[model samples]
Target: MGITYRRILLKLSGEALMGDLSYGIDPAVVNGIAEEVSEIAATGVQIAIVVGGGNIFRGVKGAAAGMDRATADYIGMIATVMNAMTLQDALEHLGVPTRVQTAIAMQEVAEPYIRRRAIRHLEKGRVVIFGAGSGNPFFTTDTTAALRAAEISADVLFKATKVDGVYDADPAHNPNARRFQSLTYSHVLTHDLKVMDSTAIALCKDNNIPIVVFDLSVTGNVRRAVMGESIGTIVGGLCEVC
Candidate 1:
């Protein structure tokens, strides 16, 4: 199949790494993701990843429990780095050369996030994984994914979610929830579709990056999304990317 996106930024939530478990990373899931990534990279598509840390820790939840917001967020960012390392190991085990970069500095673990360096890695056929959620208090990994996609000029952003796509309501709760096959940026913002945080959607809108929200639980769906198949909800200008 023809690859529609020459380069893509994949946004993976930490909870995705949990698979059937309620907490922490699952080796099988990470390995499956790495295999998919390796297959795509073999097609000469450069890939970068931004991972969230909700599985290990969620800053918003901690903050809701009355801890310092900034400190909780920082811990959450560090959790992302751990997830990043696990992903890196899985990718490397699959013989995919991967680099993990963090917004926070930790020379012992990973290179600090440098836009130029990340782009260089992609150019050299290395999958670069970004962690640490912009190293800020309130900003989320969704925003980090958008920011990194823009910085790298990724052709598209793939958001892997548990659900199939963007819906008017929670599909689990409402059987009548309408799934959108295509959408505009403003539509998502106005309707509050929860495709991503408002900041993330706005950043992607500003940079003209198309986002594909697909069901990660489906095997081969990742590859299908890369081929521009209509297997998910596409946000942004449909004619351009979908």
Candidate 2:
């Protein structure tokens, strides 16, 4: 059978691009992700990616250190542009037609974010990468991903993370942390699961978009998630308990 979702938005955390490094992008990791994306695209799935900037810089952390919140968030936004460019290069190297659309204007390096143009690119089988985190301060990339998924009318939002799925506790700190197979958006917001920011979750809940939180570190997990193979915790668009 074919894949379940025809179109998807993949939310990649910036920290996942770090690989084994303490900071900055790792070429190998970026290339691996590109490879996976390429494979899925070849199977006729339209993919759009929204990358975070937490590995290079975090707005909240900067704000905690007394930097002006707006300036710090702008810096974080630029970091995501850097990541978008890197991923674009990697995808192009694999012969996958890709485009980088930045929320913040950077005419030379990438196109400005235009919803209809992005949808056109996806229809043409070109992967679109969204950068710059909504072109607004005090907004997380998680929210950007949610907003883009809604705009693009993606069937699912694939949240690629380090953990296999959402847990009752931080899995690294709690060995016995229970991995949830599925959850409702209310459950996430109520428990403060940290799977995503509450605003992002609420957006998905309201838009009726499903989210699959899976481990990107696992070699084939991205493909699995896109194929609806039940490799991770799913949230939203469900009324039954799991």
Candidate 3:
């Protein structure tokens, strides 16, 4: 199949990198993901990634222990930086030219997030990884993904999750959970679907950017998603009528 998107934003949860381990980066898992990304890059899809920091630091967990909200969030952002570095190194080792940009402005390690620079990198077939959660404390990485997708003029946001698609309930917990092949922003909001956070969903709706939620655990799912093979539950677009 032909590529589904010319330029796409991929949202990868930190937990996905943990692999069989309880916490932190798993080199084997990182390598596996990097290889998948390389495959997509070879297919000529300009891929930009937004990585979460949950595996390293959870702001809610820190807040429950008396840590200040902003302080905890800053720590979480730092965790994302670490994760970005790990992914960048893995992608580079696989021969994929990569650039790590941070919202928090880490001049020593990464370039400050510049939209034009990022787009230029993508045009040159370089993967740009976005880190630091929008450089704001109150926002989640999900929201960051939406914002970045809009800013980069991405055709779609490929949300890589453990589950194959958006379901009415947790598929792992509820065997009878209903999977949605396609949905609209209204449907997601009306049913309070947890496929993405409200802020992120709202942003996508406003920007008219489509979201494809699919299983990253599957070896070739990334390529399939990028190829527009209907491998996931698509949400937030006029295509919901189809």
Candidate 4:
């Protein structure tokens, strides 16, 4: 068997957890994701996950209504905890060893974010889910994924989205939008592509960690990306780095 990545960070948006529901968690979708993750873990690949909470709450939404930015961000952080807890349960139910670590100190529910402990868990074949969005306000989960990838020394940041790859335009909006099989970090910046937030792109570029953007809606894309299959858009560096 060929194991391409010894370790990787998988980023899942909160919307991905929504399934067919308009909002909130969907058990079936969460279970399907857990199943895929469990299969990938069986390959001996160290996995660290960063999950978004857009389905539950978006900080900007609260801020738009005159709420304090910091307070709204805290609410957003709690939303991530909810999502993290759900994912933890699903992964454990699937018989995959997992840990939930939050940026905010939450000793009662999950472990406090500790880089060393997280690394240890991955080394021991346990999946680590990072929540709370960098433990700070004004930062998106995409930035958190890049930060965690660098901190964990992951081989690549696998950005799981609904789309299979980065396109010249919003494929959903533009039928003629074309996907780029590969792109450099500079190219992404120059084009102002929407592959990730600017902060995330800058962090990945600085840390020399490549990113793979693929469709998590597909059943096996997660495992395929970790296996080094050409199933998504390769960004930041050459395919060899990923």
Candidate 5:
């Protein structure tokens, strides 16, 4: 089956991997995500993933606790590398070709990130997982996703989250909060929406890349989003349709 998007960058939070656990990855949840990704790849969509490390360790949180900010961030980047390896193993177990590339050179475990190689992997129908953020401190994984999406020339950025879509307010707290089917990049930035970090949002905006915020917990939502179904909030030029 052909997908609406030929290529996409998927950004998943470390918290999403946590599932019901307080910290660390939940195998079942990770496996479910891997299966979903495999299904999407089978449909011929090139997928590149960037997994965050907030579940295992948050750099900002660590820095707040008096740790050297750069050191804390570096540790956080390593945490993401761990998540990437686990995800790569799961994807391979499902018989899907996957590669883990890290910004920091940990040649013993994963390949050092190279833009051309990553694009080649996607072109060859392999899932490429980008780890270790931008190899720089003070950069969030969201920014890494946006930067990679722009570099890889992805058609869209899929932000897999617990919530179905972007809302005017915290949907969990305000029962009456309104959910937006679509939103403009300016609107997101102007309102300072937490949909993504400012740097990430600005990067996507500058590159003219659309973003889809969808609930990854839903079994078929990934496929739905890839096929351009109206399942979640869309940010960018396409919001005019909403």
Candidate 6:
């Protein structure tokens, strides 16, 4: 099959890293994702990743409990760094060259986010993982994925989530919920699909970047997505007629 995308940005939620566990990272899940990413890297796709921190911390949840929003968000950013390192280690073990860059300055642990440097790493065939959620309290990793995709000029943004695709209702609760195969940017926002935050959606819309939302639990799906298999809902510009 022909590849649909050459350079892509992958958005992985920290909850996906936890797998069936209640919290924290699961080795098996991490290894599984690493193996898949390694396979894609070997296929010569320039990959950039933005990982979430919900497994360890959630700023919004903390704020709901009376904590200062910005402070809680900073902690959430740190949590993402931890997840990023874990992913980096996993990918490295699979013999893929990886680099972890953070929006926040963490020189001792990983390199700081630099646009040119990140693109350079991708050019050298190294998988670059971006963590720390845009170094802003209110911004989400979803938005970060959009921002980075725009910065690096990625061909597409792949959002690997627990669900298969965007549905009319919460598929977990509403068994009859319908999944959309493709949608326009306005449609995603007009209906509040919640596939990602509105800001992230708007960012992609402005940049004309396509977003592919698919289930991460399905093994080999990453390769399938990269190869343009019709496995998930496409948003922004991939739709022919939504």
Global lDDT of each candidate? 0.94, 0.93, 0.91, 0.91, 0.94, 0.95
**Clashes per prediction?**
0, 0, 0, 0, 0, 0
lDDT of 4 by residue, 1-242 (tens): 37788999999999999988999999999999999999989878899999999999999899999999888888998899899999999999989999999999999999999999999999999999998989999999999999999999999999999889998889889999888888899888877888999899999999999999999999988878887899879996553222
Superposed model 5: Cα runs more than 4 Å off: 238-242
lDDT of 1 by residue, 1-242 (tens): 68899999999999999999999999999999999999999999999999999999999999999989999999999999999999999999989999999999989999999999999999999999999989889999999999999999999999999999988889899999888889999889887889999999999999999999999999999899999999879999653322
* Model 6, position 115: C-alpha lDDT score: 99
Indicate whether candidate 1 or candidate 4 has the larger lDDT: 1
Query: Per-candidate TM vs. native?
Result: 0.97, 0.97, 0.96, 0.96, 0.97, 0.98
| Model 1 ranges off by over 4 Å | 238-242
lDDT of 2 at 16: 96
Q: List residue ranges in candidate 6 displaced over 4 A.
A: 238-242
What tens-digit string does per-residue lDDT give for candidate 6 at 1-242? 98889999999999999999999999999999999999999989999999999999999999999999999999999999999999999999889999999999999999999999999999999999999989999989999999999999999999999999989999899999988889999989988889899999999999999999999999999999999999889997544445
Error of 5 at 59 (Å): 0.2
- Give the root-mean-square deviation of each candidate in angstroms: 2.1, 1.2, 1.6, 2.4, 1.5, 1.2
> 35 in model 6: Cα distance from truth in Å?
0.3
Lowest summed lDDT window (length 10), candidate 1 = 233-242
lDDT of 3 at 126: 98
Model 4 segments more than 4 A misplaced: 238-242
Question: 53-110 in candidate 2: lDDT tens per residue?
Answer: 9889999999999999999999999999999999999999999999999988999999
Model 1, residue pairs in steric clash:
none
TM-score of decoy 3: 0.96
Which regions of candidate 2 fall more than 4 Å away from where they truly are?
237-242
